[model samples]
Target: MWSGEESSRLYALRRFVDVYPTITKPDRHVRFNEKMWTTTFVLIIYFAMTNVMLFGLSGQALDLFSGFRSIMAGASGTIMHLGIGPIVTGSIIMQLFAGAKI
Candidate 1:
């Protein structure tokens, strides 16, 4: 358990996180069909984006992250080439700061 002082120190961090723009949670339970539909729609969009090659780029363009493509879930020459990178980086920095109390 955190002492009062520690909790107070973290309060500001918590508030900052709360105000950050993010997807809001539903107030009520979501039905299975609704969940399935949402998942399916998102998957369709992801697949479509993966197949979309960047226009005007050469077919033999060098792929800097070819080996890490699967881990990044990004298409090397597509719109999502930086997939989840910013988000993950932000999360990592936040975690490090919180851990180090900085």
Candidate 2:
């Protein structure tokens, strides 16, 4: 349980975090070229990132999410280790909040 001051501070922190530009479904339709270019760029970045191995990771270290590799789109012990996890999670949270009218 949080004290009153702690709760207020937490609320403020939440507010601060929420006050950022989020990737929302656009009000206006995107042009085909724009969509294509955006997608291509993102894919290029993702693929490039996948090839980047993390430094100082020992080969003998175990991957905790090896089973979920296909679903997560990340390479074990690489820069893409968290692959799409953060993006997917944030999307789900936002969708849930929107559904709940929060």
Reference-based TM-score of each model? 0.53, 0.49
Please list all clashing residue pairs in model 1, or write none if there are none: none
Which lDDT values do the candidates have, in the order given?
0.82, 0.81
Residues 31-101 of candidate 2: C-alpha lDDT, one tens digit per residue: 99998999999999988787777789875788788877678676787778855788899999999999999
| Model 1: worst 10 consecutive residues (lDDT sum) | 3-12
Top lDDT prediction, candidate number = 1
Clashes of each: 0, 0
**Which candidate should be chosen as best, given TM-score against the real structure?**
1
Off by over 4 Å in 2: 1-29, 83-102
RMSD of each: 11.9, 15.7
Residue 49 in model 2: shift from native, Å?
2.2
Task: List model 1 lDDT by residue over 15-64, tens digit each.
Answer: 68967899979999999999999999999888877778878877588988
